[model samples]
Target: MIDLFHCFGAKPAHRVDTSLAAEMLRASGCRHLAVNTHTIDQVTAGDDLPVGYDTATLGSVMALVGEELALSPVLNINHPTSAAEAVKRTRQAAQLTGIRVIKLEVLDPGFKLSVNAEVVEAARELTADGFEVWPLITPDARTFAQCVELGSTMVRVMGSPIGARRGIEPQHLEPMGEMLVDSPVPVMLDGGIGSTADVEQAFALGFQSVLVNSCLFADGTDPVTALAGFRATVDRVASGTPAAH
Candidate 1:
């Protein structure tokens, strides 16, 4: 069966009440929550969040969410000025929060090939330090190979541009799925997932798991109802029910 990893908390724009999201996810029988720390952006912008919004708070919230649900907080280092800074911040966040799986963002708008080396190095360092490194990169086959070569525990492919509510970009899905099929590490679909149709499409495309954020907290949808619908869709697809064309 395909596992569902819900993005329980996210940046302020996609943020939901962490506790409430967790409760709904648990009730829906969801087993994973990828909380977003957004460290690079927050630290670079010098933004001060409430106590409960901090990395440590994420751990506390996850603990409160109960032991059954595995919580992996996404430690996005999208804005790191240098490779060393990325490694440093990753280590610091892991140390502070005790989160084992660290999700690195290497697909910033300003992404350059030059930074790939740096990101690879940071992944190596994090892995050496006993952290499970999951780099969020563009869905390019070469990039996916590079991440595996760099010791990434898993690869997260963006279904569309991050925070774009337009849903999965159809043209990109097949190619990305092909790349994922050949990846040495597990590949997860992240971002731009807006409905059960999106989830159905993701599974059909061979993604074993998905990370959804905005869809759950979208305006006009009741969060609990939305989650339950997603759970049902996952079940239907897993059970071999045909997706509507």
Candidate 2:
């Protein structure tokens, strides 16, 4: 069955209560979670956090232990400066947290969509270090191939601009499908994924996983309820309960 991972604050935004979020994660049965650079500060501060909490940053994507309630934050590293600096920072985080899955978001200082040689090099370095490098890149077939060529562990794509809260539209899926048809590595659907319909569509197309960010972390939203809904959908689809599809 295809599993899903969640990403929160994939871009710079307000702070979140890591303790509360961790509670929701366990209650909702969410096994994987990611927090971008912006959200990292909240969990890593080590000041006044609830007892029994340990801070560990995985490259922007963390594997949560559901029953134990251990929150391993998956870090979404945004490349705000030179490639070397980005790589260095990631390596340091990995060393400190023992995070294996590193997501590299090649965003320039202006936050514009950027994919270049330096960005690719940073990914290569992370991969060579044995970290599972997942690049959050624009949804382009060529760029997908480029990431795979560099030996990325996973290739994450966003059809709409990141944080746009748009789903995988047909027009975007056609090319995304073509890109994954023969990919040796797994591909993920990022951005614009907020509902069961989106999950079904992603499952049908060949996405190994889908990312949920703003939809789960938005104001006034109940993340536990939302994540439960998504998990139910996964169960239904995996069971071949035709009604769900």
Candidate 3:
């Protein structure tokens, strides 16, 4: 299942982005819609955004995406935080949105990028709470193994220049796949998953699922058509058919 994520923050680069993304996401064959805890925290204050986003907070967005859309809601607790605090926040999110899986934004946001100890601890705690944890991490052998050891049900691999829309580079794929080949847990590809071809490539490299954004909705790419391709590819891959070239 593809988990397509978007921030849709109070101050997005473009207001149209917030609305356009929401529209595209509804049509996209995404299994889950994810937002970080910070956004959820802001919206709970009862006033922080304009019309398109005013009603699109975490809880409402969760409700807005029903089964017909084939969309589930997920919360990403991405912030500098302790294990206990992260678990508390996740419990709050689960109460609010009924989200199934929680993503630990364990990786810091700045010049230096690495998964700190807090996130690993949080993953352990959340797993102990019987909550599935999806920790976002860069493509690294050691980190990947560590997350696997921590009982991560799935680890979402981030693109370099993380969150900078750079997507995943070609050189990384082979190495990333090699590092993750024998992982017991399924790995979800996060960055540079652009087309049906990308879906095929990711699966070939052992990705059980992927998270896609930017490529489909941005650059005037006709999101509905793009979304349809992804849907078909995911179906084909999941069904054990030969990956469509």
Candidate 4:
């Protein structure tokens, strides 16, 4: 089945009542939640905070979600000074959380250049340590090729810069779609998904999964209804029916 990851408790600003969100997710048949550990600043500053960083409140939420739905802790490696640091942080987080899949956030606003090589190396090391690695990357052929070459389990391509509410840009879809078709590993669309239409478009573009956040926690968005809407849209697309407007 195509997995839909609802990113809850990813940022301090979006932490609004995760218990209610968790309940809603369960009821809506959403089976995955990706929790954000630390912000890009904390990682770049080399802060030694606790496991979940400022998002420690999510610990109870994760437990509340239980075994039916899988939980993935998103470890942001966007600002690691070195590749070794990135691998160390990923390994530590996986071991601490006991989660089999570790989502690595390598792309961020601070960095202007591509860090595909560093991220690929980290994924390689983590795989050797017996952990499934999901490297979050930009939609580029070279980056996708490297991740596939390193045997990544799944690759997450952002629709836009992380945390931006601008959804997927029209210009990005063609290249993103091409890469998705050619990628050996499953490609998940992440970031900037603002509505059910965006979700429909991602699935239409051939992404096997989607990681969403901003839209769910938006000012007036009803989490329960939104989750259900996305689930229904995915189901329809998977069955080869046209998505409902």
Candidate 5:
């Protein structure tokens, strides 16, 4: 089955309530949920959140959601930064939250990453400390091979430019798909997933999971409703049911 992984980013006003968000996600058919600490300030500020509700509490809430849902530690340790500090923060967050995987996104151009070595090294350092690191990088097979060598258990390839929902760029997916087919680890697709058709297209090309953020955090929409919509589409696509629109 093609798993649906929801990424909780910045939330707009009239956003989904935390309790409802938790309930809906638990009821939804998604395999995993990635609660992003990176955008918490943009989404919810002091007094705007429910009592005792904060980004740090999200991990425990998601944990109560179910064992099926794995909370991804959103570490945005970009390039040219202190790799040790990044690793220390990531390790502290993981140790405090008791989550298993830390998700890293590379913010550089080209098919191969050149500017995010520190972030990569930090992830490597954390992995050596018994943490599972999942870094999202370009779809280049060679770069991904190096990532595997660096102790990344899962690698996410952008289906399109991040946050642009133009749908899966099938050409970019071909080599990554082939690489995923031969690798023992999971290869996930992030960005550019617009509908059920897109999910099926990616799954057929050998992606193990889809990470969605903007699609689920729609304006004036609650997480429960948005998640239900995405869950339905993911199921239909996984079951070979023709996509609607």
Candidate 6:
């Protein structure tokens, strides 16, 4: 059965803010959270930004998240320009940190098909080393197929532009969902899921999970409440209860 994951990026927000995102998910009764290390500055500075003791710092905080919040933090090794440094961090994240999922945002903006192919090759090397890699990318079936071949544990499909709340554009998803149904590996939907209906749509399409972010926090809707609604909706869809289909 697929599950919901509360998304949290532990940026410079006060410890309180970071804690709040988790607390909100806990209150809403989620068993998992997709924690992130990717921040705007980190993306902008590329690989030279100081990561320092932040690894231990993040790990300590996640370890504190009791049994209820099953944390699967996604460590972003996004900088393609510094593949070596990114790879080092990935090894560190897998070995030292509480991170189990290595979310490789390897595809930098303006990446051509060939560049994406190269990223897949690099990711293949990582997966060969026993790391469960989850490449954060578009919902392209070809890419999904390549990722599966490269040994990714799962694939993440961006539902909209990064954090935009366009609400899982049905047109964009049609092809992605088609791929999910055909692909052997599980697919996780990310970006732009604004409501319970969106969750329902993803589950019905055969996706194993959805990565919801901005919409839950930015809107006045409480994360817990939103989670409850999503959980209920996903359950119904999974059970073949059918949402008036």
Q: Which candidate achieves the best lDDT against the true structure?
A: 4
Per-candidate TM equals: 0.77, 0.77, 0.72, 0.78, 0.72, 0.73
| Tens-digit lDDT track of model 4 for 177-209 | 778776678898877777778878788778898
Which runs of model 5 end up more than 4 angstroms from their true locations?
11-16, 31-33, 39-56, 59-85, 108-119, 219-222, 241-245
**Top candidate (TM-score):** 4
Clash-forming residue pairs, model 6: none
RMSD (Å) of each candidate, 1 decimal: 4.7, 4.8, 4.4, 4.6, 5.4, 5.6
Expressed as tens digits, the lDDT of each residue in 1-245 for candidate 2 is: 36767643443342345455565566455565553343333445322222112342332112334336545545557645566766876765565556677777766665645555556778878778877788877667777788898888788877565555567755776778778797798888776676778888787788877777667656657766777777777677777787522
Q: Per-residue CA lDDT of candidate 1, range 60-110, in tens?
A: 555576465664445555446456777787766655556677767644444
Candidate 2 deviant stretches above 4 angstroms: 10-15, 33-73, 79-82, 108-118
Q: Comparing 1 and 5 by TM-score, which wins?
A: 1
**Backbone-clash count (model 3):** 0
lDDT (C-alpha) at residue 116 in model 3: 45
Which regions of candidate 1 deviate over 4 angstroms? Answer: 13-15, 38-56, 68-84, 107-121, 243-245
Off by over 4 Å in 3: 1-11, 14-26, 45-55, 62-67, 79-88, 98-100, 111-118, 163-167, 194-196, 236-245
lDDT of 3 by residue, 1-245 (tens): 43334433222332333445456565555656665565545445322222223345543443444444665556767554456667787877676656658877554545224364666777778887778888777677777777788788888776544434454677677658766677787787775455667667777777777765555545656655677667677777777888444
Pairs clashing within candidate 3: none
> lDDT tens digits, residues 1-245, model 5?
47877655433342444565566567565544444433333433222222122433454554465455553334432221355655665555554446566776545543223234655676678778877777766567776777788888887777776556666775775777667778878888876665556767778788878876655545445656766776786777668887655
Candidate 6 lDDT for residue 118: 50
Model 1 poorest 10 in a row by lDDT: 44-53
- lDDT, residue 171, model 5: 78
Per-residue lDDT for 9 in model 2? 41
Q: Per-residue lDDT for 21-78 in model 6, tens only? A: 5555565555544434333234332222222213323434455564446644556554
